[model samples]
Target: MRLELSTMRRVQRNPPCDHIIRLFEWFYTEDQVILIMERPPNSVTLFEFIKHSKGHPTERAAKVIVRQIIVALHHCNVCGVHHNHTHLRNILINRDTLQLKLIDFGGARLIAETPSEERTLGAVSRETAVRSGCECLYRVLCALIKGIPFWIRLSRECTDLLQELKNDRTWNTLENILDHAWFKEASTVNRGERN
Candidate 1:
């Protein structure tokens, strides 16, 4: 609770952003702390959304969602907040507009508090995550593109890029991942925008 409060306070110092959940107010007692948070109507966890969507989203739909997640991460990083924990369960997505809000900062760390060596280790872990395509961003990618059986509905460019992430000697940074051609491909449709 204390960690979350500190992270929220750090973010509160920054300019307003649409990606992170807004913290309206907070207070604490001896035993408990209270946080007033913005609750978007008709929003559900990304975990629930994926489960309801039959275990995976279409590539185009996944791109939209991933894009927003990336934007949120970028915004948080710019605010010196490193969300050490990012997963489906931690993200809230609106069913109607497909807007996303990252939540649960209990394990968040400020960039300055993190040592340079640890950041390098994080890069190594990122490589491992990409190699397996099962952690970090690749987990979502594998699930979304490969479906339940972990195969099918994959495009050539995307496959190659995933392979690059796995086989490349040097690990790619998050920004580089965003710059990849696969992510830059023209959006074919906004399939996830539910009525």
Candidate 2:
């Protein structure tokens, strides 16, 4: 609860992205804290979305969703909010618009804070969560697009990034990952829209 409150306060001061789940208000008693949050109607978890889609989303659809997730992560990092749990289940998508909202901040932490042995809502560290989470999503995209196992057609870039993540040689920052060709193209579109 302390972590969630502190993180929300920081984000409230420097709002991250429209894609994040908005916390409207909170009240606390001696034993419990209740947060009133904005719930998107007719939403489903990314896990369910993928499952219902039969493990396939169109290339363009996947691109749109992935870009939004990347943008949200970039905002989090800039605000020093580390989403220590970034699995598909934590992401919600509208069935019609396909818009995304990242939820479940129970594992969130400040990046600058010193690491302690305390258990988070998830067991993974911040760095590991980001790397593994992004990699898994990327692989899922590949699997969906190609109709084959991801390992069968791992691109050089994917291989390199996965290797770096496994070896613990690189942090694979969201901004850096966004620099990849696919994401760079998406970023260009976003900038054009803003301009």
List where candidate 1 sits over 4 angstroms from the true fold. Answer: 54-56, 113-135, 148-152, 165-173, 185-195
lDDT of 2 by residue, 10-92 (tens): 65555457778888898998987788788998899988887787544554566677777777776776676777677778889
Q: Which stretches of candidate 2 lie over 4 Å from their true place?
A: 113-172, 184-195
Pairs with steric clashes in candidate 1: none
Full-model lDDT for every candidate: 0.66, 0.65
Candidates in order, TM-scores: namely 0.74, 0.70
Quote model 1's TM-score: 0.74
Candidate 2 clash figure, as a count: 0
Superposed Cα deviation of residue 25, candidate 1 (Å): 0.7
